[model samples]
Every structure is written in C-alpha cells, then in structure tokens.
Target: MMLQFEGVVATGSAALDSGIGHTALKTLNDVTYLYSVTGPGGGIAVWKLVEGALPQLQDTEYFSGTITFQVGGIGMPATLAGDDQLVLDVRTATGLIGYDLNPDGTVGPLQETGTLTGGGDISALVQFGDILTIAHESTGQIATYTVNGDGTLSLSASIAGQADSMQVLQAGADHFVIAADATTGTISTYNVDQNTGALTVVDNSDALATLGIASPTAVEVVQAYGQSWVVVAGAGSNSLSVMELAGDGRLIPTDHVLDSLHTRFETVQDLAVIESDGHVFVVAGGGDDGVSLFTLTPGGQLVHQDSFADTIHSGLQNVETLSVAHVGDELQILVGAQQDEGLTQLSVSIADLGIVRDGFGTVTGTAQNDMLSGSILETTLMGGAGDDILNAGIGATTMHGGAGADIFVMQYGSDPTTINGFQAGTDRLDLFDYPLLRTPGQLMFIATEQGAQIKFLDEVIVINSSTGGPLTSAEVFGAGFGGPDHIPVDFGDFGGLEPGSSDGVQGTVTVASEAANPGLSDAEIRFTPDGGGTISVRADDEGRFDLGLPSGTFEGELEIIKTYSTASYEITALDALQVLRMSVGLDPTWGPATPENLIAADITRDGMVNALDALAILQIAVGLPTAHEAEWVFLDDDTDLSGITENNVSYETGVDVTVVDNVISTDMTSILLGNLEPV
Candidate 1:
C-alpha cells in the first residue's frame, strides 16, 4: 500500500525536542520507509521493545542540533539507492544543512553546499534508478546526486532551470521529470534526463494552468486513469489543480481544470496515496485541513472516496508534510507541522480488520537460570521468565529472568546464599563472597527436640539432648561425615627418657624408689621430643608410671618418682620420692688400710701393742670431715676404758703373763712366744 504522509511529529519535553531536524521524508517502491531527524539532545527518540509488551517510544541517546537545509519548505522529497538511504538539505543563515541517512535510518554529518549567499534552501526529493535528485529552490536548478557505498553523496550532474518544486517518476533507465510551479501562482512541468538531471520543457505546458492557484507551493501524483497526473495544492483560492500528462510528458488540463477542494486559512503543503490492495489505491491529503480519498475507474475520471477530515481537530494543529510507514501489518501516519513543532501519529492494524494469524510464527520467551529451589550451573543456564533457585560453586557469573514471576539463583559459599534480584533477560548482578561463615565465635551445639535425637549421621554416635531447627550459635551444617580419633600421651613414660632439663645430662644420682605403674589407658608409647634421645615404658590397662635410672659414683643420690592418674580422673596423692645410696668401694681413686694408711683406730706407726696408739685413735676417730674434737672417739673394739675394772671381760684364773718387745717392721718383723719359738 502507498503511504499517506503527515510528516515529522514530535512530543514530550519541549527542551528535548529542540534540535531535531526531520525534513527529508520520502517513500520508495512505495514501501519499506526512510526519514531523518535530529536529536532532542545528541540522539533521537527510538521506540523499542522491553519484554514483548506494547512498545513505548521515548526520547533517548541524541547529538546534533538545528535543521539548516530547507527541506520542509515548498520542498520536494528524495531517496537514494533503493530504500538504501535518504538525504535532507538544511537551510541556515550560514549555509544549508545537508544530511545523509543510513538505510537503517541514522543521521550522519551535515554538508554545506557552498552557496555564496549562505542562504540557499533545497526543495523536493526525487530518486530515479541509482541516482537521487534534489532541487535548489534558490538556484532554480536540478542536481542529481550519486549514492556512495559508505553512505555518502556526491553530485553527478546539474541542470539549470527555475525549480519551484520537482518530482521524478520512472520513465526509463536514465529519464525523469521535474515540475516547477511558480511564485507568481503558476505551474509548469519539465521532462528530465536521469543521467544528467537536465530539463527539457514540454510543448503543451500551460504556464498558469490554474488561474487561482496563488501559491502553487507543492505538488504530488501517482498513476491513474491510463496516465500520470498532478495534484497541485495552492494558497490563494485554496484550489486543487489536476494536470494531465501528454505522451511527451507535459502537464495538460484534465477534463475539469480547477476544482476547489477546501477554502483555506493557509497554503496546503501535504499529499499522499493509500493503496487498498496491490492494484487499487486512493489519492489523498494536501488541502485546507482535511484528508480526502479519491479512486479512478477504468474511464479517465477522478472519483472521490470518504474523508477522515472530520476526525481531525479543526484548528488545533496544522500539518505540512505526510509520510506513512508500515510496522508489520499496521499503518502509521507521520505528519510534520511546519508552523509549529507539532507531530501527530495515527496507527491502524490491518489484522484488526478480521484477519487471523495461523502460521504467523511466535514471540519467544527467554529461559535462564532463574529458579528458586535448586542449584544450577551458570554456564548451563538459559535466561527466561519465573523465579528460580540456584546452587553455585566458586566462580563469577550472571543470572537473568525474562518476564513475570522470575527468580535468580546463586549459591553463596560452602555455607550460604549471596544475592537475589529481578529484571529482564539482559539484567546483570554481581555476587560477592560470603565471608561471615568464617567468624570465630560461631560454635556448634547439639539440641534434641522433645521427641528429637542428635547423632553423628555416619557414626551413629547418638546424642541425648534437646533439638530445634538448628539453634543459633550461627552454625553451618553438613551431612554427617566424621574423621579419625587421635592417640594421646600416657603416664610413667608419657614424657619419655628426656634428660635433666637443667644440666642437659645424666648426673651423679641416688635412687629414691622405683615402681612400674603404666598409665590408665595403654597408650602406644613412643620417644619424646624428637631431638632428645628416648625412654619408653608401656602404660598398663590402668595408666601408671614405672621409671628408674642407675646411680653414678659421686654420692649418686636422686629421687626416682612416678605419678598415676585414673582414667578420666586427676592424680590426687603421691609417695614419689625414694633415695638410695652405695657405700662399698665407692671411690675409684682410694685404697683399703691395715696400720700405716688406716685413718681409723690404727693410728700408731710403731706397730705397738700399747695404749698410747689407742689414745691417738680415740682423739680423731670421734670427728670426721674435720677432726677437731679432743679425746672423745667412737672406739675400735673398746680396747681402753678408764672406768672399767674387770667388768667388761674375764680371762682364766691361772693366767700366764708375757711381755713382747716390738722391732722396727723392716728390720726384724717376727713376733715369737719363748718356749714355742725355741722348739
């Protein structure tokens, strides 16, 4: 269907609408649309999708300011390539604003045409095959511009002619036409060369076909009634001029010359064609302020169809240019208001007219890791609608939900959950580490519910305690899985053969006592502290201590001790110190004595049988480490006593008394009885 245009319409914040230049509007092959507009700010307002609901267009990313090339004023429209692109020329005090649009409809840099007055403006947009045509109203000439691959434009050909407004329709590979209506309230048509944009005036052209078309400002037409024609909108009488084309391409009068469509308060500036099907279409718009439709029969006559003009608010707004775009099966009308920054869009869906979509495909829903109860691998998850639960491992990842009732899942750490949020499929949230599970004060406690029981799951080690959910203490839980128990130290040899901590060696010692009491529990005894050599004594069924060390020579006195503690009980009493000493040949450097070396009672060196030697022994033998005592001795055999008178001992009644004299022991060492020696 051909579009019925209402040109560039805008709304919302007035400040945001400031620099939007939306003048280069046109239709191609009559479908797939193209137009350009400036940003309210640095970018333009785009209407896009959220979660597949009805779309809302609001002002968004923007850039350039002000429309300088005069595209919307008494101007014609043009599109380059196919629907590949379109161009809008701006009119400014400095120079005209010229913009090249991408096929996808984005505004690029504006070019200045180098018009010396710095005041030239562009009117009309026309496309003939690969070339795009623009008419400079100031120069009254036609310029055919070429479309480059990178979406830039350069002039290919120029032809001088006073252009009021130009329109081009396909004639041949390189042929086109331009109609320049005059400021003197007249209309003229020219057959154009597409290869050069050169003008050839047609012979049958009537200079002022409609006498009252005072401001023959804009003209539009599409083929009907076996020929191409023109609908010229005028300012003075508000008349519509119907111009017919001769075989050579000149504007001739139709059966009816001038038809008064509407008495206007302003010059009419918009026009359009609406197709009902592929073949039939209605010519409409460009009048005092209403939309009227017309259709042609097989005969060469123009027939009027119904008008939606009554639906329009009479004087509330004025529309200058109109373009229609089909979004799917729906038709949207865009009207550009010249006098005021006014825009109105009216849309209607053809499917709403009793059409059904059977094979119409679908609008897919997103599926992601958005569940509430279980663990999920982020890499395996797809984004979709609905709440979800996720169990995560150690990593950084994204979770998204596309639509209603959506849930996002993330496993926090070994112990907990970290983040939860809701948004569209593209929304992203970051999960930080769950650090609180590491605090020191959190302890594990076992509580048994009334009828509840506590036990290590794997161990079957039962606990008889009260239970609850998992009583505070803020404990993290795991499925019961326990490890091994460790062996402990025993008595006696628990701390084995370690040397005396003081002198670092086995010393002169005395044995106090010895006992072999192994510790309560039989521990696997082992050497103590690795570097020190070892001592080992096994612990009995009842833990006890049994330890001793051999004595050395220097007084060798030491206390051998043992401490015993009952299993799970503390040691309370101890009889631990036992001392032992050795006195036989204790010194390796000294010898035994008879007389000369005897430090005891044998004190006389004369080898005597007399009391004088006994008296010397008595004096010193009574005192030891120092022999200072006088005449008081611990006796040897009590040989001399002052008070004794035959009471201590008695010999026979008849006693023989003999006297012996001692010799020097080396000179004559024999002692003899007289009778026994002579025999």
Candidate 2:
C-alpha cells in the first residue's frame, strides 16, 4: 500500500474568521463533489474533482452570501435519482437550505425550503432515497422531510430523540436509522415505516457501560464479510466500538475495540467507511493531528492498518470530519479540520490489502487449485501453488503462475494478455474462443524474434520464451485435438533448445576505431535476452568474436563497453544481417555484408584506397602536386619520411672523388603507401 500526500486547500471566510467543520461527498456521472461547511460566515463550499496529471480540485461555489448563517452539516444523494437532478441539502442554524447542483458540480443560489422551530441546532443530516433526515442536537429530535422535484424539502415526520450524529441503513425492504447521543453515551436504533415514514423504536444499548463509548460523537454503518456492523466514535473516552446489527435492529457489541491507547483517536469526531475490492476500511478523524485507519476482518474484528498525519497542515486540533470518494480507479480521502481551516486530500492504494481491482469487479485466488475469471475492467489473476485454470474476458489482463503447471484460456477479441513464469512442456494455452483447429487458415503461427506470434485475424498473441529460441510448429500446436471449437496447445520443449545446436544462432562481432586500425580488443559485450536473463562475451585480441545463442527469435539490446567509451545497439533475430560486426570505417554492419572485409579499410577517407594513394606518395617523393588531402602528406619532407620509416633505413656519402660503383636502389614511397588496403 502506498500513501501520497496531495497537498491541501484552504476553506474559510475572507475575514479569517472560522475553520471548516464538516464534509460530504457526492459522485454523479463520474464527477465528484466535495462539500464543506466553512465556519461562521462560511456557508457551504463545493469542490469538484478535476482529472489531470493528478486528481485536482476546482472550487465550484461558496454560498456564504445567499445563506448568511452558520452551516453545521451537509448531505447529498448516494445514488443518482431517476429525474437526473443533482441536489444538496444543508443543515443551518435557522433551517435546512436546499440547492441544485449544476452539471459542472457547482451549486445554485440557496432556497429556504424547510424551516425548524424551537431553537433549531441541526448537528447532522443524511439523505436516503427521497427522504432527508436531520438530527437536531438542541431540540433533541430526529426530523424526516420529503425532497421535492425542484430541490426543495417539506416536513414529513418528526421523532423525539437526543442524537448528536446519525446514519441510515437499508436491509432488504426495511429502512433503519442509528443515532448516537454524546450526553447520555447511548446508541439508539429505529425502524422507519416505509409507507408513512414514521420512526419505530427497536432497541437501545448503553455504550458507556459495555464498550466504554463515552460521549459518542459519530456513527456509521458498514457492510463487511456478509454482515452489517455499526461503528461508533466517542469524544470523551477517545475510543471506537464495533457492533453487529441484527435483523430486528439490535446492536450487538463485538470484541474489537479501538481506544486512544492503541490509536490516535483523541476526541474522535467523525467516521467514514471506504469499501473497495472486498475490503472494508474505516477512517476516523478527531482532535488528533491525523486520520486512523482500520480494516474489518472476516471475523468482525477491527484491525488497525495505519495512520496518516499532516502535522504541519492539520495539527492536533479539532480535525472534525472526513469523507472518501472514488474517482476513476483512485480512492481519495478528504479531511476537514476545524482549527486548520483547510482540507487535506490523500491518495490511497489498496494493493497491500491483498485485493487487486479488476475493471468493475475484484478477483482473488487461493493457494489450492482454483479457477479465476476476468471482469469488465482490466484484471490481474495470480495462480498461487497448485495447477489452476485461468480465464480472461474482453478486458486486458496480466496472469502469473507460481509453482504447479497452469492453463490459460484466452477469449477472442479480448485485449492483449501477458503471461509470466510460464514453464514450457508443463503449462498449456487454450484457444477456446478462436477455434483455431476448425479453421487453421484463420490463425497464423509466425515465428518472431521475441518468441512466437499467434496471429488470429487482426489480433496478435505473443508468446515470449526464456531461452531466446524460436518455437516450432510441432512444439506449439497440439498433436491430438479433442474438439474443433477448442484447441489445447502445449509449448513442448519450446524454451529448452540448447545453444550451439541445430536450433541455435551463431554470430561474430568486431570493434574498430580511427585511432586503432585493427580495432579495440578485449571490449566487453552484454546481450540481454528478451525473455529473461543476460549473456556476456569479450572481444578477442583482433577485435573479432563469435557467440552461440538459442535459436529462437531474440529481441533485446546489446551493450559494448571498452575503456572510457560505451555504446549500445538494438538487435532482433528477424533481421537478415545476423552477423553482428562494427567498425569505425563503415556505417555499421547490422545487416548482410556488401563489401565484406574491405568496406571498413578505407584509411585515406576517399571512399576507397586504390592506386590514388600510391600516386599521391610518388608525387610527394618527387616534389610534385599530390592528391593526398588528409592530415599529413606522405614522403614530402625528411621528418615525414623518418616517421613513416619503421623497419629499414640507409644513408651513403661520397667525398668529391668520382668512383664507379654498382648500387641497388629501392623506392621508399612504394613500400610505405603501396600496401594500403580498405577496411
């Protein structure tokens, strides 16, 4: 699991008056709206999730001018309504204010639709279906209102209760409400009549006596491991309590209890559950500097996972509320701090929870022989120990097999899939959807440099081999077929081909530079196999070397390192020029040869060194015009002759007397430049 701090956004009045007290999230048509109450003159400020290089925020609206009162809580629809209307209901000091959310996630002007009498102090608000429930802390009453089509609310029913916080849950056709009282330290449960919208008291539990839930501040209902559990946070005791909800709306306390001694739950204020990939995570925020994380186990136990604290931005003050929203494949946690006057966003990855997100669903496997399938989104399937059968759908997939032999079933028209740790002669590939056996011409098994390519119509399935050997038709296509619609192919001894054999590729490499004619010797070369592993060899004294590699199509990089200089070359087995050779004189021999050995021997740089070099040397020796236009003219001066002279030199002097002597002479110019050859 990885945690990324995505900075913070300030939310308060221009006078630096108050802090952000509450937060809520609403996702509509792939767009998410984060609503926060910015203290005194800070009405409701809406932030929209904008997709960019990273998930960012755009302030859509701030309703402080329209509603000139303090807002305590805000609520939005969990799922989309049939009319496709985006509405937000906010709890204020006077009454409930309703606003319509525009397509861009911004809110319109506030409309005072519903008003509460007798010292209205709304502490919490939640919307379930078309019913908006408001918890009035000062009046000690729970009120339910009907949401009109025009984003207005009308009073429907009122029930007597003392609740500082509230949450709603629906089981089957029954609607239940759970409320927590900070004064009495009691948790009350009620069943709402679906027809009349009347609340019926079901049961109550003394949280202070059994679970030490003193001054319960917030309550949330989370579904985990095929059961519904109610989680509560207490401010006075600074603890968390987990209770199982029975069918009759009875709260049963679980053994798992999160206290301040174990977690940073000081003055716990709010609780939110993030459900993803078959895992349930509870996020709690309070006077503590950071947010605490806990995962619900299969046995209904709350296991503390980790905690995130931004002490610089959100100190150990009243870090009141938190909410989570899913944007695309990312899960973002939004924290609102009362003292910090800002909102902190955190990105979370649940891979450490052993849960892999695949498209719209999550698929997991066991250690024994198991069967796994794909989903609408990209999927990851892991075969643990025993032989398993894995099936891929239309989505892209990544499959890996552990110890035992495994089988993979690939569907037609599906996205390309990658197979890792596929053992040749053991595992098999099933082309069940394509029916390659019935119509053999529809599929072509083309041998590629990486391994083998199974071409089906417009799609290509690449089989990467570890030994860098090409897979033969006989080694891939099954010998005996059980049916025509499904072909079970086995890669028998596909990657088992030995080097230097008939199924092996042999190539020679040579290195050269302008400073050294023959080439740089003892240069180290490295070849990285496309499938896996690496092979290394060194150049000989003559800068020439030979290597034998597995015959399969190879696709990877070749690196050459000598002295202080280094170079790299991309090579593939499909190239016609398999003989890898390089020289400073030629453009580089990555293909078949044209001039062969003499191509790189052009030392005079005239494209070719022929009789022209000899003619230039003769002209220099006789003090005539020379065509040699290189750095130094040969045989022009005594120093040039002395520098060119390597093996033989002779000088004779006669003293003014004439004498007849027989002498044999050899021209030094012919010996020095006549033997020049092209590389």
- Give the number of the best model, judged by TM-score: 2
For model 1, the stretches where C-alpha displacement exceeds 4 angstroms are 1-10, 15-86, 92-104, 108-120, 145-159, 171-174, 207-212, 224-226, 255-267, 276-287, 298-300, 310-316, 325-331, 338-341, 346-679
Model 2, position 523, has a per-residue lDDT of 43
Q: What TM-score should be assigned to candidate 2?
A: 0.49
Residue-wise lDDT of candidate 1 within 1-679, one digit each (tens)? 1123333344454532333334334333332432424432323333321121222443233334465222342222334333333333445424434444443334444554333231345555566665666666667666666655544465666666544556665432324464545564545555666555455666543324323457666666656434465666555544445555544564543322223332222445555544332222233344345444433322212333234442343311444555544456555555444334544454443332211101001212234212222111112233344322222322223222344333222223221222223332322221111112222123234433321122211111112112223222222223221111111111122233322111100111111112222211332222221111122444333322232111221111111222211221211111000000001212112322222112212223232223343343333333222222111111212122233221122111111111112100011011100000110
Q: What is residue 212's positional error in candidate 1, in angstroms?
A: 4.9
List pairs with backbone clashes in candidate 2: 359-377, 449-553, 469-552, 470-552, 600-679, 601-678, 601-679, 602-679
True lDDT of residue 73, candidate 1: 27
**TM-score of every candidate relative to the true structure:** 0.40, 0.49
**Candidate 2 Cα outliers beyond 4 Å, as residue runs:** 11-18, 50-55, 60-66, 73-95, 114-121, 148-154, 206-208, 260-262, 313-317, 351-679
Clash totals for all models, in order? 81, 8
Candidate 2 residue 511 C-alpha distance from true site, Å:
90
Write candidate 2's Cα lDDT for 242-305 as tens digits.
7777566756565334444335567888888777767677878787777777655443445454
